[model samples]
Target: MSQPAAATNAFLVATQRALDYAGFAPPSPGATCVLVFDSTLWNTHIASVHGLLNAVEQARAMRFRFERDREPYAVGHAVWRIVLAACLNVPISAVPLVSTASGQPHLPGTRWVTSLSHSGSWVAIAVGEADCIGVDIERSPSQMNLSALMPRFCTPAECVQLSGLPTPLRETRLLALWTRKEALLKAFGTGLNEDPASMAAAENTIVAAPASCGRTAVCHVRDLDLPASLVGALAVPAGAMSHRLYWLDRCSNDVYGCNSAETSIRSN
Candidate 1:
């Protein structure tokens, strides 16, 4: 776990408000909670590293080619351990992990759905009972020029919204759409194989039954609140639709609450 709580608390509070502004509902108990962290936190909780890795034998036995890449690799692994430990209310050493040929990390025999994403010093993890889930955090300070990328990812309506927004909002709206599409893609585990703009999922609220599941499959996608410099989104299978944002820096504490005034939903 991250050693200090003060910084983590402040970051989480700001992120919680960001989530509220993006039309996120007060986290439901059954939906998994999303936890955000800064990459720098990977160094502070150094003392717990060994135990955290050993708890999951698969992680301990892993191999890497370059020594320089080890730290960042370990950081991602450690974040997963820390988040899983916090969620299970258990010690980091007790968490177990399994690797699959598909490369998506799994929790041995458990049904928990998880997704991890990091960009520009920030890392986020979303866990829950949903059969499939994806979470993404994007830092927009250095994001690409809006005009160059929108045609590749945005639906016609999204593009119209982009053109209609005030100059100050153009970039922000673009990032929001990108993050939402990325989250949806991650949830499907389909990577870039399918067109994000054509997913046909509702803008932030609709859960559609995929044709493959005999019209019974469903996935929910929506935006997340984060610091002004960052944007985020979450996706979950309909089986588990509740969600809450959490701060897990110390591995055990509720740093934010859902008492903020709810904002009206924004239409894309």
Candidate 2:
């Protein structure tokens, strides 16, 4: 495994320790859990990685009451294993794996959801059995072509609004809007091919409807107050969503969970 990012290594170690202390080993009698992780950080050792995969497969096999080869599902399953191993107290190898029709990862038979995104050197994921959830991370590079993509991915109004801003602010706003729409699409279970510009973020929610899995969907946008280095957005069900934003500087074991009361937004 590549060394975890300087900002996240310590947090991963502490999380590992907590799981170990909780007796969260693989092969629980029978239970289901959500696993989340940054795909870029996991190191895959054949023996160790497989061990965690086995644990999750065993759990899934038990859930389905069958015996079959779960190994095929374990090969590209690194991130799934790490998150399950930590959050669910199981061996990373033991997390069950499933995918949506559009190829988005998911935990089957329940509302438990997980999504992944990678930007530059960083990766992020979110796992929960919430009503709906999506998380995305992007590397803020100095040379992103805002003008070139604005027309393609942004609405006419948004493009005009973005163009009106000072160069520096316009660049930041373009990226923020892009990430928000992308997160909304991921949550809606549709990738970029879904034409995200149809959706617009207004007053903390996305207003345009995007097509996903052959159905049109909308999302509530909640801007997360992370460090200036990071611009994060979350999408969940409108009106009833509970958005808990956090800045997890893992290398320092510092997780800043936002405590502000839940805010409501309407996408319609």
Candidate 3:
């Protein structure tokens, strides 16, 4: 086989092995599946995965000035396509993933809704049959200027709640709150274009759409239990009662570089 063809075959085989290792399952009615993967796992296979991206995604990945930014973007989108393909039972290239003007991705003409977020080394993808869905993952920074950001994103009440905590606790809580609000905004499809302060950050609470949204919506936001260094959240229309989370990391065997015995599936 030609070098390019051989690389493509290797990626395809690896993707299948990963899915099989995870015992991957599609999201069902009333539930969403959030897959979190370490993008670095694909570092050695960048060429193989880059071939999986569409022209637009390829151009966007190339636009990144540094390999640090470029590699993750390619790996994230490639894995996203793989997951969606498995869910729809189609070839990876056949998944009709498209982005809105604001860059939130979705499956055009399909029942499945998708939202993607990445932070530090991790990339998260949420998929389900909800009217709308959003997922966000953020790595906690060692330091931040909380005073400068809190007012911009937090409501008066939220600010009060966060301020009452000690500095360390406050910073941690704030990051968690930020993820929830971002997820909710993405689910509303307005992203940060809408005033984040207009929505509260309380978990499992119904969030009303901001006046600028020009429509009424009740979104449910929940905190995701992730590794200590990372905070994540999911937002879906109220109808979606729960979600399942799967961590996709490299296994020790390292041949396929996709499976992980440590992979965990959590439902809530």
Candidate 4:
């Protein structure tokens, strides 16, 4: 084969391999698929993944000012495109993802609602058929002054509940609650522009929507099962729906090799 043809063929093979490793199956109708991956695992393929991004994403990646931040942004967005392509049944490059004024990413004319979040080295993406959807993953901090933050984001009732817990448990629950609130706000496409303390994120229950969100609508928050160091949550408009979780990781023996493990999380 000619040299250029050979390179193109190799690229195609590698792309298929990565997709297979990610287990890029479409979410079941009316369900969301949440994929969490360590962006650091894609470090070796940064150049290749960077190539998958569009101009806007490329410019955004360039503005990161630090390599550590840039790599994950590139890798995360590349994986996001891969997931979106699978959902839309299109090639990765064809996914027309755009960000809203508040910075929530979505497909312009599609019914699919999407959200992305990254913390430390982990990135999480959510795709589903819903009125709106949001997902967030956060690495628990080793130490933080919860007392200084609670009043800013926690509701009065949440403060009372958390105040009764032991220190360690309170810290963990605090992060979980933060993720839930973030996810809910992102789903509304208002982000932190609305006060996070306005609504309480009680698990498995419908919480009153913020002023930016329609007064009649409510949000349902559910915590996600993640590795001990990380906490995650998903939010959607109040209703019945399902979600599937997948973990994408690199093989220990080969930096270029990839694999995925499916994690089943029961609904609340």
Best by lDDT: 3
Off by over 4 Å in 1: 1-29, 45-73, 86-96, 99-102, 200-203, 207-216, 239-241, 248-268
TM-score: the better of candidates 1 and 4: 4
51-148 in candidate 4: lDDT tens per residue? 67899999999999888888889878887887798888888778989998878887987878899999867899999877788899898763567656
Question: Highest TM-score, which number?
Answer: 3
lDDT of 2 by residue, 1-268 (tens): 4443432344345445433433333322221222222222233222233444455454653363321223323322443456544555454434555666686777665445666655543455555555455666565643578767888788878987888888778888887887788777777777776776766764375543554446544557666555566666666655433433322222323222112222333444
Shift in Å, residue 205, candidate 4: 1.9
lDDT order of candidates, top first? 3, 4, 1, 2
Clashes per candidate (backbone, < 3 Å): 5, 14, 0, 0
> What TM-score quantifies how close candidate 3 is to the native fold?
0.91
lDDT for model 1 comes to: 0.60
lDDT of 4: 0.78
Clashing pairs in 4: none
Provide TM-scores for the models.
Answer: 0.66, 0.64, 0.91, 0.87
lDDT of each candidate versus the true structure: 0.60, 0.52, 0.80, 0.78
The order by descending TM-score is 3, 4, 1, 2
Q: How many backbone clashes does candidate 3 have?
A: 0
Which regions of candidate 4 deviate over 4 angstroms? Answer: 1-22, 142-144, 255-268
